[model samples]
Target: MIVFLAALLMILGLIGRMVYLMVFDAEYYQKKAEDLHERERKIKAARGEIVDTNGTVLATNRTVCTISVIHSQIKEPEVVIKKLSKCLGMEEAEVRKRVEKVSSMERIKTNVDKETGDKIREMELAGVKVDEDFKRYYPYNELASKVIGFTGGDNQGIIGLEVRYEDYLKGSNGRILTTTDARGIELEGVAEDRVEPVAGKTLQISMDYNIQMYAQQMAEKVMEEKQADKVAILLMNPQNGEILAMVNVPEFDLNEPFTLNQDQEISEKSKEALNQMWRNGCINDTYEPGSTFKIITASACLEERVVSLSDTFSCPGYRIVEDRKIRCHKVGGHGAETFVQGIQNSCNPVFIDIGLRLGTGRFCDYFEQFGLLGKTGVDLPGEAATIMHKEENIGQVELATMSFGQSFQVTPIQMAATVSALINGGKRVTPHFGVRILDKDKETVRELKYDDGKHIVSEETSRTMQALLESVVSEGSGKNAKIEGYHIGGKTATSQTLPRSANKYISSFIGFAPAGNPQILGMCVIYNPQGVYYGGTIAAPVIRDIFDNIFPYLGIEKDVEMQYTN
Candidate 1:
């Protein structure tokens, strides 16, 4: 009777303890139970796409699967390895190593196609799973390869616009709260609590698909014909600073960005080739503007009112400054000519005289005003340029060479943007590619913007410069650049390269069309071109061809009917 009574009292005390626990620790115990059964897994957000102004997709996504294995749940490791190796085209050992990893999930491969993923899923091999993911694709292949750079393995933009607009392209990742049993088996009939990932914003760029193709085609043809190391071409609107097309050749396939396009055995040479392949010279690299820079000096002279149309200067083929004699293109000299005629003749000595007149202080001021002293505020990566001479220390020789566009380095885009200013009523406009950002629903999130630009010269000066440039195409060094029916004004430049003995050169051309009210501005730079190295002979024709193709597409009517002869 005493033992029964003690048992009953003990039972009552345990019940009292349970009641106290339910009342005091209920919330904490419930949370612990929930945590034991639930697991959270990441859901990768879909990367945004890139499209041209016409809504033709340039960069898009491919639906792919990420194949992974849970080591704890994989019962027959050998079977899983054998099947995965065959389906994924990987080594059996590689599959085995991945399956044996000490982790919740080991990714065997990513970017597996749906058909291949379906084949793996049909096997239903224990612990093997296929999850949804995305792979970036450039449908246009090599078109605008540098401008629309390819992404990395993790879908991050590594170059060009891909890197420039990363924040908008990379969206927030979501998660799935899965309910699983103690043995790592997902519970039956229990719906997964999901937080859906938001898709990234889209990048609407200024590149037109047809225009990009035209520019690239011209670049490729010239790159092969010229047998040049590389070629870069850029076309932009002088008014708004929108880049219509930018091409760098030879272009590599964006799909296989790491693979070398050239036929080369794997070595240090191959490594260098790869680095050179990915480089975007239009923005990241710098080259001496050569004769293309002459326009800057002329524009500066005109803007500063140091030279007039009627002002006459004599060129004895060369000018003497501080023991140095800078020679003109014409060895015999263009002696006794008006300032306008000097520009038409592209007389180096005449420019040297003009440069000496401006002095270093005044010339550098015009240079800074023209956007050469700093970056153009372009929305790209790795912009570069060099101001060889400082204003404070400028001497006779330095000013002389600079006057004729020598001894300094600037990128092609910088020269293009500055040229636009010279023609576009002297407005110092900033060059740019992006147009606007759009949400998943195609709603306008915001406008991709740039500065409104400042006036660097009077309208009258701009008009006068346009006429002089037009004369260059009509009767000067740039005559070959003329599109018979349209008035195309441009300057030709041939610059000497390093190690003066090597005789390498960069041949370039900068031009605009419809001389009266110029619309499109362009510049082409050809590096180490074989055989002929004159800009008028080599680079000007390339721009002329590009203009021939793009002129009609842009609906810019030929002001005068000077039918082009094929």
Candidate 2:
């Protein structure tokens, strides 16, 4: 009886200790469970707005409804899945699979709109919940789609202006982490959170919507008329380097990008097409500048004092340099011509002689000075620098060819900006599309100006180049670009396709409007036309067309007093 009592006493003592731990240490176990159920929820801040120069909204985001599912609360998984599949237009099998995979019972459909949210909620379906999210919307549709770009499903900019200005467009994401109950409901207690999100800033572009639309229409019309492989158009303020309009033919709609692409396997051809579509061709593509480059050669020669304006060269069809014959565009020859006449006729042999005078050392010096050896560093993506060949092979013949824009490749924007500098008093300005960046309160944080200038050449050289260019339209090869009331100056280019493969050509026209006191500088390019690929034939007329509508529409003074200071 004494031994039995001792064993009973020991058992009672052990039971008492067990009871103490269960009640006194309960809070410790509860805290660990809470930690396991805690979650950090991301509160996404809204994306910034993209507006035109005139303050028209190009892209914006708005709050919309979303549907979610919680497996633990679901009374009938199969029935709920079936109803959700029908209402959300999702496959029943897919919904069932998603519901089954919910480790803690939270899945979201990501669809927006009150009608859809209401339809799902009307079912009184267990486990279903409604939430709000911001969705991107583009108002312009296909207009300036490539320029404005688009956002992806994750609300991130993937290309064009979207990707270029992502830092300013994507706002910071705020987050919160809190413990939840067994039912996945937040407990009324302190929570862990992060800093509040900073809303994205607004971007006010330099684009003129009306001009953009017209330019796009003109590109489309030309693409159809010329049956061109590709067409690119750019309009800008020559005096300021501000881009007023930019358009590329075969434009893809940002809201519907899938139509242009089918399978995602990227090939060389597909890559080229994608680049052609996604990139702004004015700054992205490089081509032999053709005769348009003649002006640069003339400028180099004039600036280096190697050739006088009245100097003359006789051409009996071609010039022989190191046993290589350089032929003129006229084939048989331009015969005899002065420096001005040489530029007027775009005489290849005359430019060759001028290039020889400038010499390899001097020519390369001016080439780099003109900003042709590197990228323009414009505020766009994929800006290709001029393709300068090996300087070792830059002999008299090569220099001659380069003088006329044949030996080196250049982008259209490079040509435009350089030409603009040539005419705008030697002020080498950086070209830009975005005019300024504004905050939510419409406060300007950044604004672009043209006075950030570097003098490329003397004022005399600029004036001389301007006069020479004007003469081309008035009495030379670019007569087709002449407007009755406007003093228009332009350069025509017919660059030969590489490999001399079957004689293909890429024609281009670049010029500025109201030649005196210029306003708009424009460039148009047509790649591989079936027939008549001369820049004057295919490209100049396009410039004329653009200027014709643009002048009157822009309300620019056409009958302004002609200042004959030059």
Candidate 3:
């Protein structure tokens, strides 16, 4: 009787403790259980777009179906592998290994085309699943390849404008939480939890497709004809520093950038080829400005009042500065000539005279003022600065050679920007490619941007330089660059490669069309060609080709003779 009474009391004590625990921790336990059974979901945000100034799509994202398999749900591994290999067009062994390794987890397919996705959905194979995601597409393919750039496997920009503006291009991502079944399907009628996605802003660029195509076609043709190692062509608006077209050959296909962006693991042959293709030579590679730099020299001389257009100099083939000889293009001499004639003929001795007149002090100062000695800060990737030797104390020889565009290295963009100032009312305009940013809904997020130009030289000096350069094509070394009705001004360059050890040469030409008003400024560069590699022979014809194709597109009235010839 006493044992029975003790047992009854113990049972009553245990029941009392249970009642207390349930009353105190009931809500906490219930919440924990609910959390354990909850489902997680990802909400994808839209990527930013890249477009042209006129709303033409250069880069965009498209919806694609992703296929995955739940290994645990696949009852017959070998049978499933066989069936999957057939549907996916994959090797049977590959599918078998995939299924064997992770039977219970989801295995993602590489990518599924529209037909494949439809077939898989129709088959409704057990454990198969599909999801939507964004994939980048370049509608223009190889067109403007270097300028537009491309992305990597993770949907991130790896190079060019895409990489440079990744933050702005990749918008905010969203997330969600919900209940799901064992099959990982969302539970019916479940409100769950969610975070809204914010789409990325779209970007509009200054590039014109018509102009880009023309320039690219010409660059391809010239590269082929010259059998040149590399060719880069650039077109810009001198008035506002707006880039219309920029192309480099051999070009890449954005659709097939995989091989293009490979690392060292790729073949050495592929690495070499890809390295050349990726240069964006116009902005990344530096070359001696050659006689093209004479414009800067003449401009500085005029600005400093060191020399006048009427000043006359006697050229004897070469000039001596600190015992270093600077030779003129004319082997014998240009003889006695006015500054105007000296410039028209691109006489090296005359420019050497101008540099001496400016002296070391004023020459270096103007060099900096003209935007040489630094990067142009263009809106592109991999910009190289003008490589000037450490000669803060410029000697006579250095100054003289520099006057004729030697003893220093400058990028094509910097050279073009500096020349643009020579004719654009003497304003130092900053160069750019992107015009604006937009959204998926076709709304403008950012407007066109321009680099604030600073007036560096007198308007009169600019006009005089314009006339002198115009005379070059009309009656001097750049005669081949002339387009009849349109007054074009340009300078030919054949800069010897610096570091002397390489024994390489960079042939170049820089010019602007409609010299009277100045619409387009252009440049063409061929690096280390086989033979006949003077700027006149290698670069001037490229300028002519660009003008030939792009002039009509710009609504430029053709010369009467050109119309008749057509």
Candidate 4:
């Protein structure tokens, strides 16, 4: 009787436990069971398209295929390996290794062409699964390659605008769920469940396709003709900070960013070469602005009332400060010239005098106030800051050299932005490319916002500087940049590179059109040209050529009457 009762109690306990599992833990166990039979495959989402202001697609996507394999489902292993190896252009050994692996799902290859992928699909090879994917494609290939950037194998942005705005450019991956048997074989007559991916938002930038193309052609033409180490051109609207075109010559192919353009084998050093090749010199690299920086100095002096356009000055071609005698570009010296003439001649002595008169304290004040001491806060990444001497470290010699756009370094974009502020009604504008974001339906999602410009100079000072710079292009050293019927204001710079003994030099020119009310501001920087390293002779003409072509294309009408005189 006791044994029977004990057995009955044990049976009841077992029954109670069974009841608890069925009622209380049913959902947990049900999910576990579902997971065991469900085979999950990821579906890659399409990246957003990058278009210019005119809706010209600069970066888009091309449909490709990702070929994966389920170990248990694959029959005729040798046949599968052979066909995949040939179709995917991979080694048979590599294909076999992945196919033979005992994994539930393994990616055999990705980015297979649509034609080949369709062919494999028609073969109806068991265990082989082909899913469509998107690959970033640059329609113009090398055009604006550095600015547009490229993606990695994972479809993530690696550099340029691609990386800078990754969150807006990358999409959410989806999943494909299939019911399978214990052996990982898909069960027949069961429809696969799919979670569709959401594509990234479209990016519309301020870059104009035509302007970028024209500028790139001009940059390439000049680089090849001059045999320059590199050439960079930046064009923007001074009134607003919208970048129209930015060209860094030797631009890599956006489709083949990792491969070098040169005919050389890949090596460990190739990584460094690739980094160098990917560099956008206009913003990434910094150099002495030479006379282009004089624009800043003149603006500062004029703003502080330290110098006037009519201020009399004498340049014997060189100025002696403290223990240093810095020679001017014109060794004979510009003698008995007004401040306006000194700027036109780009006489180092005249600027040195004004710099000293402004005093180191005021000079540093203007430097910091002009936004030179910090980044320009551009939307792009890796923008370099100005390299200037510490305030306390700036002695008379330092101050003198800094006066004529020497002894300090700044990026091409920095100078362009600052000069824009100086000439464009004293409002300091932020240079930018990205303008708006759009959804897949082309509906406006968000318009990019920028910091409001701060007043850096008085309007009177800005107007005076504008008229003075116009004279420079019309009658001064920047005469090469002068165009017919246009009031072009500009400055020329020929700065020697570091280790002055090496004799390497950078020639640069910064200019703007319709000087009375400037619209476009452009700068050309040519590094270490083979010969004729004068900014006025080489750099100035490049801008002229680009403007000449772009002006009409942009529908900017030329003034019927001449605005400035020689």
Pick by TM-score: which candidate is best? 4
- Measured over all alpha carbons after superposition, the RMSD of each candidate to the real structure, in angstroms, is 5.9, 5.8, 5.9, 3.7
- Estimate candidate 2's RMSD in Å: 5.8
The list of candidate 3 runs beyond 4 A from truth reads: 1-46, 72-76, 102-105, 174-199, 260-275, 498-503, 558-566
Query: What lDDT would each prediction earn against the true structure?
Result: 0.86, 0.80, 0.79, 0.91
Q: Estimate, for each residue in 1-566, the C-alpha lDDT of model 2 and write its tens digit.
A: 99999999999998888777678877887777766677555667788898888998888987766676766567788888888788778888878887776556455577367678876777787767665567778887888877788887678887778888899889887766666676665566656556566778889988888889888998899888888888888888877788888887778877765434443566787667665567767777888889988878888788889998899899788888887887887888988899899888888889888888788998888989988887776777778888897778787778767878886788988998888888787778788877878999988988745344688888888778877888888889888898887878888888888878768888888887666656788888888887778998889988888898889887766654444232
Count clashing pairs, candidate 1: 1
TM-score of each: 0.90, 0.88, 0.86, 0.93
Give residue 11's error in model 3 in angstroms: 21
Error of 1 at 419 (Å): 0.9
How far residue 538's Cα lies from its native spot in candidate 4, in Å, is 0.3
lDDT of 1 by residue, 308-414 (tens): 98999888888889898777878998889998888888888888888889989888888888879888888888787655676667788988888888877888888
- Residue 474, model 1: lDDT of 92
Top model number, lDDT? 4
Q: Can you give the lDDT of residue 550 in candidate 2?
A: 84
- In model 4, which regions exceed 4 Å deviation? 1-34, 260-268, 560-566
Candidate 3 whole-model C-alpha lDDT, 0 to 1: 0.79
